[model samples]
Target chain A: MKILVTCKRVLDPYVKARVKADGTGVNLDNVKMAMNPFDEIAIEEAIRMREAGKADEIVAVSIGAAKTEETLRTALAMGADRAVHVVTEDDIEPLGVAKVLKSLVESEQPGLVIMGKQAIDGDSNQAGQMLAALLGWAQGTNVSNVELDGDTANITREIDGGLERLALKMPCVLTSDLRLNEPRYASLPNIMKAKKKPMDKKPIDELGVDTAPRQTLVSVSEPPPRAAGVKVASVDELVDKLKNEAQVI
Target chain B: MSILIIAEHDNAEIKGATLNTLTAAAKMGDSVDILIAGSGCSGAAEAAAALPGVRSVKLADSAEYANQLAENVAPLLVQLAGDYSHLVAPATTNGKNLMPRVAALLDVMAISDISDVVDADTFERPIYAGNVLSVIKSNDATKVITVRTTKFAAAEAAGGSASIDSIDGSGDTGLATFEGQDLTQSDRPELTSAKVVVSGGRGMQNGDNFAMLDELAGKLNAAVGASRAAVDAGFVPNDYQVGQTGKVVAPDLYIAIGISGAIQHLAGMKDSKTIVAINNDEEAPIFQVADYGLVMDLFDAVPQFTAALD
Candidate 1:
């Protein structure tokens, strides 16, 4: 009953990312990097699953450059038993990432895989579902609750209007959404122990997955800024502005 | 290019987001067909065919599609992939769940939540919570896309006489079973498409305080929304959330009461035509984007504001 979780190095959610002047991408040069917030929740869920005696071992996997090892270390510190880093300098798209994960899933044979619904950086929100499709496994995306019942997993997912509960067979994929759980901070002792944990690294090419780019990033630019307006002194002034000035009401 | 829009519906009527996705597909200047997949959904298929730019409607009626399960729906989409150059859906949670699987099965990459259709193969989408916009050019033979409904105008619901055809259904895939759902029952206008949106944040204090917003919204005929902090505090359900991860809304008038807007929350409503913030904290960031700011406690200003509407 081993569980596999994914972690990604991303620009910290707190910091506003600045687009490069040349319309290429965000300037990650010396920007604060941390494990994607949602992935932290995924790792935390896997740790809790093990703690509840639902599974035996937990493996944290990441795909990125060398900096991704730091993210995996953070996952290890949080409670993953080991780490796997697929080294690639290229910023792989969701399909490529899913393909690489599929390769790893074939080799690792974990019973379940938990991943962040979307990386706040790309906001693609595709890899987990794509991986499930490729593997012909059941998928629960944007899931807030997971209860494993022997070979079946009961999942509560966030949908457009409200919540939906589903019962999925084992060997499924679950993508963590907000409200899944509040992620815990790694203790100093746990961080030191993570430094000594087993971490396996492999080149992305070794996975034999086609890491080709299907989309060319044409440009990146800041969105049109909203102009600030004057402050109204009272609620009556606000209502008058809404009625006469803006004429929205 | 021929575009196949996967219609979002509940076997009763086509959702408004489907019309918005249709508008995005129509923007590509291609013939657009819609696929309506649900058990006993012929009514929806007929309605989909009535959309202004629809060329035809393909309906797959089966119990397997009742819940819109990704595994079952993706196979049906992949089965029909050969006839179209692009597969599109609105970026609702269901579409977001389904399209990637379809794209993966077709061995193509999906572009999610595109705010603009640059061309047949290019798109513009928001990244990092809409602070930055990225233009992308896809080289895939079959482009799979999910449209951000808030960004596009919805296609008109009528004026087309497209034919509706019954398509072969994709049977059950034994992978997942629908247990149940607890959708919030609301008679009010949907938050995303409402003319006015009234949202509260952590300043609202507790769940009981939302009654003030409810009364205000009732008078204004506006939808009620909550910030992530409010939802996280259990003051409201997740569906009440209005943010990047929640529902992106761009109503005509958006009133933020007691909401110290976070970047993610602002991303959802900054496109709104007229923004008003009511918070005691004059330095709240919500004021920066607001068209009119009122520095007053929500408990006082909300009731006064609601009374003024009378």
Candidate 2:
């Protein structure tokens, strides 16, 4: 069966994000971008499923501007058979992105769809569940472990208290969580071979989905700063301050 | 506007986070109803009915909802969608799993993890791991939202008693079946609800080093937590993770050892009342938010701190 994984290009988590002076959005100019950490885990899980003979072909998909192709190539180097890039310059929201993914799912007919639980940038945590609802399919969000049976996938998800396991039937959606797996780095040879992999690019309009955003961003501002306090000379001094000054202990 | 809150429960009892969500929902106006969807959750319904500001409780009892599977719960919520103008829940794992599905089925955008309710249609949410706050205005007729419970105080669990009404369930979708669960059985308080939390980070190095944190946590009667870096490094289970994508905790006293405090990790705990940082690196971001900073190796500082508490 074919497995489809959705990858997103996001500002590197290591970089300090700055809100634009105009308060429209985050400043992305000259910021290094990489595949979202969660999406990287999704791609890694898909490749592992294929290696285990649970999947026949792995198709990696991404939606973004031209720079997203680099993320798709990274997926290829990590072992995706091919890739499809939905080219768009517009800043699509989670619902819009889900609609596009739904259209792709209809056309591709992949048995399973795996993607990140949320993008590090927007942190909406909505697209995968929205796509599952649009398709009227079973979904396991924040999945940490996945075991494939004959026609069902047993997914263990990280929950508030602990882990919950569910057996989702084929043609379901699964979102990767932090504990899913340790993502493997792309070796130099694999990176070289990824250039020769097939990459198909399509305009966002071609998907035939209404990509309009329902919510308007009024402003973006820096979070209230917490004033740095003084460093204690000794542990005894820290305990004294906690007891007397801060009174928290 | 009438709001329908999806209560997070485990069949037996209601979660405190649900009460916090009620606090947020009550701010959106009056006539708030809590919906309890679980197998044999009458007790949870009773708990919901006792919450202050809740006008009523809707109970959907069915075997299909035993696990609160989104496939079944979303359809049930969509069926009951017409009565309420807003659907809200605490931004817990269950809420995050279920709300988007309900929103998608209802054809509305779900505003997630909102920290503030700006009027009825506008909301404030954090993005970029809480580095930036974005104010959003939703045009959807029916707004779907998940509240960051840490941002609001939990509504009183007992006071005004609301009537409980049983609601019919939407039949199971049969798309997914619950296998089982592996909940971390701990004597310590839950991370989200704990008054004091002791967290470790990548500096812990390995799983074995977490024992030191457990020792300190045990002494302080604190819940143990870990940064995303510690969880990613296999130093702890995912449940111990406290971050933007993990559990958002706002304990009264938070102690961080060996944590560099990435923005994501800080987002989960920055709301903490008094943060204490113990790290060898003075430049660690954890120090910025800490009320008390101790620049020392965790291996030496943790033992001394724990002993000092004794």
Q: Compute the TM-score of each model's chain A versus the native chain A and list the values.
A: 0.99, 0.98
Candidate 2 per-residue C-alpha lDDT over B1-310 given as tens digits, one digit per residue, 9 for 90 to 100: 9999999898889998998898888888798998999998999998888887788899999998998999999999888889999999899999999999999898899999999998889999989888889999999999999999989987788997999999888988999999898888888888998999999999999999999999989988999999998888878878999998999999989999999988889989998988999999999989989989999988988888888898
The lDDT, on a scale of 0 to 1, for candidate 1 is 0.93
By summed lDDT, which 10 consecutive residues of candidate 2 chain A come out lowest? A224-233
Best by DockQ: 1
* TM-score between predicted and true chain B, model 1: 0.99
**Candidate 1: deviation at residue B45, Å?**
1.0
Candidate 2 local lDDT, A35-85, one digit each (tens) = 999999999999999999889999999999999999999999999999999
Q: List the residue pairs that clash in candidate 2.
A: none
lDDT of each model, Cα atoms only? 0.93, 0.92
Chain B, per-candidate TM-score: 0.99, 0.97
Off by over 4 Å in 1: none
